[model samples]
Target: MKIKRVSEFVSIKRTVENGTDEQLLAVKAIIGNVKKDGDSAIRIYTQQFDGASLESFTVTVDEMAEAYGDIDKEMVLIMQEAAENIRSYHQKQLRSSWMTTEENGTILGQKITPLDSVGVYVPGGTAAYPSSVLMNVIPAKVAGVERIVMVTPPNQNGKIPAAVLVAAHLAGVKEIYKIGGAQAIAALAYGTETIRPVDKITGPGNIFVALAKREVYGDVDIDMIAGPSEIAILADDTARANEVAADLLSQAEHDERASSVLVTTSESLAQKVAAEVAKQLAELPRKDIAVKAIADFGAIYLARDMNEAVKAVNELAPEHLEVITENPMELLGKIKHAGAIFIGRFSSEPVGDYFAGTNHVLPTNGTARFSSPLSVEDFQKKSSIIMYSEAALKENGAKIATFAREEGLEAHARAVEERLK
Candidate 1:
């Protein structure tokens, strides 16, 4: 990893901006073809990309039952525990439709309603993230989404991972489809003969999947165009360099594009953490990927003081932030942006990713400045409720009519005028 003085590295940009027009055009072609040709387009793309010839895309009911039997008992228990924690966390976010009446006989409020159906796409290739299933589906279930559909790639043997199946079952997914990549996104957005279109699609996948989601966003809602996993550590001399190095490597191992950065006030601590990262990297199974990530996107910066380090972190706005200092809480008031903040040495990124009872699907690539982690709100829609009594209309209708007329909308003015009469 490269080490630089904080003053010099403070203005670093994380990832490149969004994709170019050519990339968007390719995604658009895929979406349009899927919308036009339906299942035939899906089959062609699936065979071309996933190396699997599917006689059918949707998983059979019996297959789901078989998955449960195939999975290990111990793994099943772990998934159950994770599901319960995820459910408990999201249950607090559940909202109900409500209304309030005034003495003037006007009722004004908002109604919360879950979407009819949602689609979740899980990446399948080198790994299967059962945790992702819990993160995506539990929030939808909590929001009362009627039907939750899942899409994942099948292995060359045409079998989904047992853990993936078990996680889907625990999260209350209604259907699972053996499909992946842009084609799977197309199938979800447009719906094939076997697959029904969903109101929204959630979860993460590759660049093709991200581009597909970006392409199909207007047709169906998506959680966000997640870029890559990232973690930033803000530490002081008080922090243990070994622990900080390990935490950074945890995110670095995610992918070659993932970023792991460290900003500290003490130059000595920076040097120690750099040595620790090199030592830990040798032992990591995914060391090559982590090394590339650290080489390209990761860094250790020597800030002049804690405030400078905090400023650099806020500018980076990493998906995960770890503050390990003598007084971690003291910096919390200074932090204006971050997807999730991990305070103290023990509160590492993985804790929040797994069992911390907080959603791990976070904003990436500086999006934490405005976007939020996936939650129950992503699955539910809100509608404004407005009811005015005759007297109330008489009181406010003129203002409404005047405002509408000022905007040169005659129909709007007439509607209010007739109501008043």
Candidate 2:
């Protein structure tokens, strides 16, 4: 980690990936083929990319049972508990259909409707993310979405990870497909013969998957295109150097592009944390990845005061923000623009990533300035409700007609005027 004065520090710059011309063309062709050939196209791509030739893509009851048997009983219970926590938290976000009635018999309101269906694309290469399963699927389930389909690539032996399957089952997802990459995204967006089209898609994936989602966006809604993970800690001298280093590394190990930053008022604490980060990096299982991430994106800034530190953090707008000051709550009102805020030394970043009720699917890069974390609202749609009685229309129709006429929409004007007559 490099140490610098707050005035000299520059925020990490991570550009959003726009796939190469070759990759974009490939994704376009994949989507086109899936649209034309349907299930057969998916089968061909599955064999080529995943190296598994599966006659069937759907996970069967027998396979689900086998997955349950394969995972440890204790781990299964932990997943169940995590699912419950996620469900409870998102249940609070549900909005009821509401209407406001006027004395002139006018009724206006908003109707909240869950999407007809949703496709969750879980990444399948190298690592298994049962945590991703819980974070993505549980919100849709809580939002009352009836059809939730999950897709992940299969291993060379044509097998999905047991933990992934177990997490999906716990999250109430019945439809699981053993296919992945750009082709799986195409199938989800356009629908193959075996798979039905979904109203929206949510989940994180590699660059190809992100490109596919971008290409198919208008046809079907998609969650935001996510970037690499990030964490920014606002700590004071009272904060433990070891604990702060560990929290920063939690996100650094995620990827070489991931960012880990610390902004503090205490110069001594800043030096200690930088040294501690180096010591701990040597012990991390993903040391090579973390080392590059820390080298490329990590930093420690010494601020003149708490106010200066807070301002720097606000400018950074990290995906995850931890407040390790003497009084974390006192600064809450001043701090703004983070995807998720972890208060105090005890609330480490991973708590929200796994056990805590909050969703870990957060805005990355500097998107936290304007965007939000994945939530139940992403799985639901809002419909404005307007019911105008004869009396109300007679009173207001001429005004509406005039507005429409001013816009040069004669048909719209006439349509409203006809009702008035």
How high a TM-score does candidate 2 get?
Answer: 0.98
* Alpha-carbon RMSD, each predicted model: 1.8, 1.1
Model 1 is weakest, by summed lDDT over 10 consecutive residues, at: 10-19
Model 2 residue 287 lDDT?
Answer: 99
Q: For residues 1-421, what per-residue lDDT tens digits would candidate 1 score against the true structure?
A: 7789877875435555356788777778888888888888877777877777888878878888899899889989878988899899999988889999999999999999999999999999657889999999999999999999999988876778888988998888869988888888998988988888999999999877898888788889999988778999999999998999999999999988888999999888899999999999999999899999999888998888888899999999989999999999999999988999999988988888987778999998888999999999999999999988999989989999999999999999999899777
TM-score of each: 0.95, 0.98
Against the true structure, candidate 1 reaches a TM-score of 0.95
lDDT (Cα) of model 2 = 0.93
Global lDDT of each model?
0.89, 0.93
lDDT of 2 by residue, 1-421 (tens): 8899999968787888997999999999999999999889988998998889999999999999999999999999999999899889989988899999999999999999999899999999556999999999999988889999999999888899999999999999999999899899999998988999898989999999999999999999999999999999999999999999999999999999999999999989999999999999999999999999999999999999999999999999999999999999999999889999999989999999998899999998988999999999999899999998999889889999999999999999999988866
Q: What is the lDDT of candidate 1?
A: 0.89
lDDT at position 55, candidate 1 = 82
